[model samples]
Target chain A: MAELTCQQCQELAAELALDVLPGRDRAEALAHLDGCAGCRETVAALTATADRLVELLPGAEPSAGFEQRVMTALAPPPPPRARRWRVAVAAAGLAIVLATGGWMLGRASHDLPQPETDAQADVRTVMFAPLTTENRQIGEAYVYPGQPSWVYLALDIDNDTDVPSSTVRCELVRRDGSTVPVGTVPIAKGYRGWGGPAAVDRETLATARLINSNGHTVATAHFRHTRRR
Target chain B: MRGVHLRRRPPERLPDDMLLAGLGAGDAQLALAFVRRFQRTVFGVALAVVGDSGLAEDIAQQAFERAWRHAGLYDPRRGSVQTWLTSIVRHLAVDAVRVRRPAPVDPQDLMSLIATITDTPERRVLAGETSTELRTALAALPPEQARAVVMAAVHGMTAVEIADLEGIPVGTAKSRIRAAMAKLHAALPTPRADHG
Candidate 1:
């Protein structure tokens, strides 16, 4: 195909900026943009320009419970091991309590901040869905905004897995498909593992996953980092 | 004692940008503040496009969720939080309209549109000077040009849809939108690097 001239690129710039370019034209414009820095800048400025029209219409308030609904929709699914883990953890606590014969019934030292409250407190939840059926592990990462490095991750393993703590690994997946090892996630309270406030920043982090010593992924989930300020 | 002045304390509330930054960081209080700050604009634009309070509510909800999820991606250099968010709500609202084929644009809607533009509290508090310039520039456009652009923008109309609405040729509709964009850009001031 012949190289597109600046004029052709400019003509399509306005339409593309408005997101109204026909598919064929859009494809052609993108092809040109791959090689044209000037056109890219023009498109960006024009897009900003087109977006300004939004300010003209008056602001209106939506009905209540809308935020609640959105948050609920975005909530991470219950961990795969939750059902079994709940029973095992409770039973184990009871057994330890009965044997020791000293501690209070509800007092276990492994108490982490409940994520429901964490979410209510405005900590962003970075949910990772299972990448495959074999990898039944799910993850919910909590981080205070602007402090991406200070991530608190909860990894839920499948009820059947028995990987030793010495071999477990957790990683932060990035948009470019690279992985950064954050730390190990041990089997805490039977199939539930927690790790991090890892030194990893949220800038490129896309997914958080668990891996076994065998180099196989145990569970993986994706994250959407929309706020970049 | 009469001549002594007390030092002023820092204001307790975060500015819009800081609140958004906090929301990006997953601060719940700031998230609520951000919603309180921009919900009206988000919902209003959605309402104008979708023409139903309920559907607009859905669109607005999705828009805010998107803002929260993608807060880290927002660039202050590009536009203010208000303008960037306005774009998101407008696109979602327009998409909602496309999907449902909601009520056709009534002439009275334009009168109401004018009223909203004139009376919005957000326009004064949230919108920066360029937004004001944009409003004036849009007003200065020939009525047909302004209408054509609005139809394309808030309604997500194509050149053909705009042509059908105005009883004009597709090329004419396209040029009117293009011309309006040009005029608006010319009339507005350059975006400030410092403002969010």
Candidate 2:
């Protein structure tokens, strides 16, 4: 991973705050954060904002029996009882199952005390952006973050409207509105095709578009979160 | 006079923190109250990310169980019980999808979340927030940027995930997230000179 300068660290602070900066970059940024106060403060403020974003999603009701199910799941095990003759007879049959695969052992494990689940457990986030032409959905982008985190694109461009190319250039628009070439993907028989790894860069991207062999934009997908207030 | 009148309030009507305290102490009624109070919000959060009602239900249950177990450790300074529980369920739901289905949700599907949800006083209470400064700042942002920031902030998605999900390059994803967050952070109230 390239070592991040203070400027770069500050630039990626939001990713770090949101825990989405990709692997080595994340490690590099955290190292920079340890030595840099301004960056830490910047990241902290973003973290606060990120935390507040949860309020935007509205709550909805679960199934009717959910409450009973939750309470029943939380119930403690019944006390182990002293055996009467009939109980002892039933227990002997149960002992056979316990000895074979140890079903009772599994049940016993739950009886033990458990450590409190951390409120701040590590969570992986996924994003899906649709590809469109003239406001018509044509395909989608599937993304996951990790070491060299990945993106896969599935495009089914309608040639009748999209001016499909034998091959299409996948171009991404940057934060500065400059366009970067990812690569070209071929259409074997028709416009329907898919390409992967999609060359997700380290810089922030604004939009993605497909350019035809004629250098004309055919389909574009603008990634926007339109969560209403 | 306020104190005299308050004593008549039902256990179900107790304040959030008090209910949380009761939950931590394993008070059956209070625990039930806590579950009832936040179940919808918790279930909604779970369902939003996973997009599966059954999986969402399991996640919601686990979230409530976690809340019941960890209520004592909760910090009011961090957020209200509702927000905290939402956070828990959101993480759980994300984790569930990562394990059950790694594919990204449709951008339209996510956009529909805002459109489909209605604003209500109940939602505000569930959010455990009255001050709209942060939300206002988020709203002030361009639609694309706000969505990027929300995907990162609420869903715990990274720039790579956003890049992949948006079918954009990683740089563009990072830039959108950074720019959005910076704008939102700028909107936060500045603290006093007592800064640590």
Candidate 3:
């Protein structure tokens, strides 16, 4: 095996500080740094230099409400046991009410043949930014209260439309107006295609918005949830 | 009112280390101060990487929250509060950028930032004497090498991405960045231990 020299170590150390070292070289460079104090100091100095360069970029003030958002995210998690207790109590009360209503209805309509159960599943679709006759937005989501939900979204664009090469990102907007990033897909700028089949975990679905790389809202669709009767 | 007056002490301004410690202890006011002190740098780094203000805001928020949560683990011996916080912001921003391809940044973008800094206190400090030194050092490098280093440092562009942007070969791009860093390391003063 060829012994790694000091010059080679210095070169790799620079790459390590920049974070552009190919993964294949990372192990060898790290092994060198493990035993070499001088190289370690050099890497640290380079890292410090790289960090100061961050000061050069023009600063952008965060939008209004950004501080509030950070504070909210850092707030302590609410007591889940209490929430669960409340939900259990509500479910029990609902069951009792349904039983009583069934008993009352049976007594009143014994002669009437039992009505056919409404077995149809409700599916909802929404459209956002129906800009032109040729361009439209359509989406559908299936959600069950306690399980992960799946979604599908599509955007229609006029063939003549000119869009720069862009990627699509989708967010799951909950009823309370909070959002969770669901997924992202890359496609041609003007290419019309479906955005997801993304699985959503937390937060009840309220809407999904497709956004471009420039943060433009290409289209949005509202979701309506219905409980089985 | 009398009890409140008796209990109140003047809000003594603490140094950055104390403020960081307070943030770790969940001192809300200190957390706010920390955020205010560093938000510009955090937001600036995020904007440089993602190139979208809204997305940059999200990344900055995450960076601050992460810093606060992990403040207990911060060891001043390793680096300064600013250095530690900058690392957090850079990590988040780079991850955000690497996961997706953002709009390509033009070299001309550097000129816009080079415009004489004004408005914010932080920028004033950045534009002050230290930046002059940094600018001089940057000027000493070949223009192509300087641009490549800036692209790597600011935007967290890898060698391959720099090659694509600069229309150079990947091997050449990598060498340029490595060579640039060596020159910069030689040029800049070793950051003071005070930064730790």
Candidate 2 structure quality by residue, lDDT tens digits, B1-196? 0011101235675667656655654557867888888888888888877778998899999887766654534455555666667666776776666575457767787667634432334565477654356556766778778778767765667777787888899889888888887777677675511112
Docking class of 1: incorrect
RMSD per prediction, one decimal? 17.9, 29.2, 24.7
- Candidate 1 lDDT, B1-196, residue by residue in tens: 1111212212234455555555655556667777777778888888888788988888787777767655544545556778778877777776667666644677577646644553435645475544666776777778788777777767777787778767899889889888887777777676421211
The deviation in Å at residue A116 for candidate 1 is: 19
Candidate closest to the true structure, highest TM-score: 1
* lDDT by residue for model 3 (B6-101), tens: 111112444565556556545577678788787888887788777789989998987777665445334455566776777677767776787787
User: Tens digit of lDDT per residue, candidate 3, span A1-229?
Assistant: 3445667877666667776666567667777777777777777777777766666566678888988888776555533443443443443443333334321121122222332111100111111222111133332222222111234333333334454455667776788887767678554422233333344532356667667678876556665443322
For model 2, the stretches where C-alpha displacement exceeds 4 angstroms are: A1-6, A31-38, A78-229, B1-9, B116-131, B190-196
DockQ of 3: 0.11
For candidate 2, give the DockQ. Answer: 0.13
Which of 1 and 3 is the better model by lDDT? 1
Rank all candidate structures by their TM-score, best first, as comma-separated numbers: 1, 3, 2
Residue pairs clashing in model 3 are none
Ranked by lDDT, the better of candidates 2 and 3 is 2
TM-score (0 to 1) for chain B of model 2: 0.80
Local distance difference test, each candidate: 0.60, 0.60, 0.58
